[model samples]
Target: MIGTLDKAKLKERYDICIVGSGPSGMTLAAELAYSGLKIAMIESGSFKRSSLAEELKEVQSEKLPIKANSRERVVGGASSTWGGLSALLDPADLAHWPLSFDELLPYLKAAAKYHFPSLETFQNPSGTGWKFKNLADKLFVAVRPPFNFTSLVNIFNRKGVDLYTEATVAKLVSQNGRIKKVLCRSVDGQGFEVSAEIFILACGGIENSRLLLVSGLGNEYDQVGRYFMNHPKGYAGRLHLSKPLPVNNYYLPRVVGGRMVYAGLRLEEELQKEKGLLNACVQFEPDLGIFQKYAFAIWRRMPGFSTKVLTIFLPRTLRARWFADMEPRAENRVILSDKLDRFGSPLPKVVYDLSERDKATLEELFSQLRSGVERLELGKLTGTAADVLKVVKDDASHHLGGTRMGLSPQESVVNTECRVHSSENLYVVGGSVFPSAGCASPTMTMVALSIRLAEHVKSKLASKPRRTFKNQTSRTSSQKILIIGAGNRVRGDVLPVLESLPGFEITGIFARHASSLFGAHRSYDVRTMESLSVENLKGARFLYVSVPRETLAQVLSDLPGASSLEVIIDTPVLPAVKKYAHKFKRIHVAEDSVFLPWLDGLKGREVKEIECSQSVFRYHGMALVKAFGPINYGYRLGNKLYLKAGNTKVKIIEPRDYASGKLKIDGQEPDLTAIIAELIPEERGLLGEIKSTDTIVSKMGELKRVGLRRLLLAASRGEETWSLEEGLNDVRIDWLLHKVWIYLSI
Candidate 1:
């Protein structure tokens, strides 16, 4: 009764309560704000100028990332301060999205019309080739996503949109599983209630999940607050052209139907298949520093830097990075945190880690891109693949998941219409409804879906007077079961797998560097034999071992505890490891041999080999813990490698990149003093026990008695099933042989 009549002043109830004032939310609000059906649009942040002024204040104070880049609170949500990179999601992502492209085509076009009246002005891109006779101009630059729809919400708000700024929803009022009202709070500590026939959760991905978790309706799938994903994006390698290109790569057009100006890259599906890594989609990013410098340079040379010629001439000579989209599996996800926010609502604690397959896919993707540019006459490539290293995995405060929409209630959180299955009148309108964060940006696609949803809702609102259509006492949108997974790809195989996921939780990717003979060193090798732990397989539902055939068991014997399924994508040897086939989900038949010769070269290369332990990486004397949560698990400390050469005779080192430590031997360090453990002592690690107990068993007599090598291997396996007794039976065999036969043969 309190929630029902809380709107004492208003006798009439609204048809919808639209949350958020960002691109998607604003369009929905603008479309129905003046439809005369009674609508209550809410905004978490106020649009007042005071907030906008505060933005530049941080420009000099560390120049933190933008709101869309990091911060979330401000007027108009993130849209108020976006770069206007309204790049429509790639066709591949749209095709793979939960909602169909055909279904969203009209709505997308409508959204463009509704929000962007001046949209045609920036339709096409035009620019001229750059002349790089100078050192700065010689760098090769490419295209990236754009920022055009900047003042978007303001455009709609000026058109009679009922505005409610600084309004935060505390809880959703429910009656018989349907939302009856929204409990809202003002910045001034005042409270209000909005009664609506429909409710849309448009508070961005993170906030949307926060609302769900806060409202106490998220315990069902364990999938609710899981699979929090992001592109794990970063500025990677560049195309340092031998000669500069025609135009600058960062020019965004100001006016219509411009050539869809974007630098492009392709996923090498052929190679990725051998690794069991799914290729979602791939993209290219232009150098921002180059863009900034060039623009400023023009402004300095010619004070009036706003000339059309300047725009046309500077986009060519710059560096670019290519991005590959990854697969959507159950392991990558969002989970809830016990931490509360200013509003007392729990903040969404995101736990997203990547799998070995994701890293392998990324490594393969970059190699293909590099090879395409160098050998295939694509372009002149610059920088070692290692130069393109950094990855930002903890974001998507832009993308999120958990409440995935699938064909069945058992698999998804919502139905086809972006409605939660367990609740009524509630529809997720922001990127939160997106099951997967494909390689592309999600705004355009989400906006298109909201528009379609709005019309569907409008049609169903005939009111009590027109009870014929309502004769059945139809349940709310929350009760409707939507067919989420049925969709078609506009560009199917040509696009990456990430492009194919929609309304599904594909989370972004797990990234790592690929080992190269003339390039960068590797992190781990699963060939001959490899050891790892269960905890190390965190956030993983899929495992693809790319090692030598003979060593398949050496690597996979301990992996069963990490994931229910294991796939052997490629191996160095064959037939030997093939015998253990019955234990794995599938085996990738190797028709190509890029990995074979590479295995032969492992003897000379320094790579980290890993195993499992209770502690992953130690920092400040604290051990990183791991356990299964909503959707994914955490990473464990697997054994890493350390070189025993040069002055560094026995200094411990991390295996993959072979990053040396401060404890270098350099003559001062003792020989044979280095030791690497995959697990913590007491938890199965041989070195762990030594390190923890202050007991160093270095004598040969002690080694024989304790079965040191085998015991260490078992610790690396990190699963009780392997029994601390026999984890390294395979590893010790190689030791007996003194040198491996296959190692010499290759």
Candidate 2:
């Protein structure tokens, strides 16, 4: 199933088509192998590197030089030269991520299981006598043999996955909001096409953006190759210790659990936050060769003192090297070059510029490190700022961003699920979707996110029956509904759907002030009410509550026909209201968070497992039983919901912000939302009822001109646009809020 051959040798079609055989693509292929979906992975190079394949990597750069050799076109991709340094992004560094640390932790652990199996203990050094704010701590780096596709070729051969090497993806052809086919070329000038239900661009950062730009796929927001970032490394300074300290293997490479691992040092998250500094780490290498080169210069400056100092502390001295985060800048980008490769594909041009803030961060980091080392008496630093600058290098080969993920198409190239904003079935994987690059190597994180993406793709492929949308005819015996909210969701979102439904009659709308109901139609019966009364609930059969969380309890308590009327409450419900929800004839709370539709789609299907967001944890204990019926379930230690009902076993996780919003059944995610909207009586014809763009414009327009201008500027600069009505409306902010609530709740 794994071979390097012509493009004509590939299968006619597959369930999933992945471009690139890098770590991200390989990890995803492995995860989806046994999920009953056929996978096709395309790599431009064969098992080994070649001159022709390497020529494709040649790129033009502006300020920072592009390391053409950093990326290998062979089956292993960059792993050919990767240092194998593996570490989770610091919690502080993850502030820019859509998911939380806890949500991504499981995937990181999964990736670590494969790469850094024998993890050495990471502990802070004690009794260093360094009384400084920032100190060096332990960090784990994987020194195992680099992982290449050939290593996993046998496993892939057995699974439902096929790897095709020497296949260069030329262009992605999309039709009707979905990727229809991928046109590819072999090295020998053979051309072919591969079709798939879902297409994933797992290519490296530069290529991913380049392909999208070339094909005009996901550039609707003009953000395809924007917000480029990378880690810049340099020689920080030198340290000469008074005496040899008890340094552990964490600071040096050593065998642990039968694997070679080394540790480095990073500034604590708290200190970085306090100083408003970028994340950075330093490693010390005892280099006598470097000392010998610098000895002559030191001897010329001070002959006798230099000789005595060098003799006493020659072995104890260490050369310090630092790696720091680069801020994402729109100007620092990847664009299509005028030059073309052998295949007639345009080459990439990378424009990178180091900001003044970056230099200041490096200066502060070294100054603090030196102060700490000298104060602790652990070491005496002996290097000028000029010496540090002189040894600085431009490239780390870690390209990030250009396909940044966010909740909206206007601000990012991809959605939180890694799906390209413009194309429904097109997804981008790798460091390209990273909003910001932390100080750590991106390979581990790339693998982790890819694993998560595999589960999502599997689930999507499994739930196929419910993916289609069908128009429904109106019924004669319709129910009377009343919306009780003072937000634009009533007029812009709920009202249109209600009016379009055949049997649903809008009785009345209630709000505190007439202006609060600004978007409502004049034909509708809109009324101002100070408080809920029996008259308001007169003839309504169903009540839709979309009020603020604080007012939910009051609205629930004031309900007049609680015994007969069915109530649909928006999610993140108040605990007190949930406790008394059973009082109604029938109650259904809307878990509007992304994964809920997947659960709704599985209503009549035979499901093996169901995983959902834990945003509804308050109602899960009772709501799940009420929804699924007679299920035996228990709570796992990691806040996972484990349930077994009949032949089905379910596990649910409340994801951290940056995690994927997907529901899985039997390790597969089906288009349950579409199914639920089609099959379910209550949800029929109401899927995608909210128009996010319209609601966002309306809510944003409510702000003063000056405030709106400020937000527009921030959004343009790739910063968070914290709106007050974020969750109250149907804007992308709801998706963002759902992801970041764990941080905001604190």
The TM-scores, one per candidate, come to 0.51, 0.58
Q: lDDT by residue for model 2 over 669-697, one digit each (tens)? A: 45433443344343332332222232211
The clash numbers for all candidates, in the given order, read 73, 17
**How accurate locally, in lDDT, is each candidate?**
0.42, 0.63
Off by over 4 Å in 2: 4-8, 117-131, 136-138, 290-314, 464-746
Root-mean-square deviation of each candidate, in angstroms? Answer: 28.9, 22.1
Report how far residue 291 has shifted in candidate 1, in Å.
8.1
Q: What is the C-alpha local distance difference test score of candidate 1?
A: 0.42
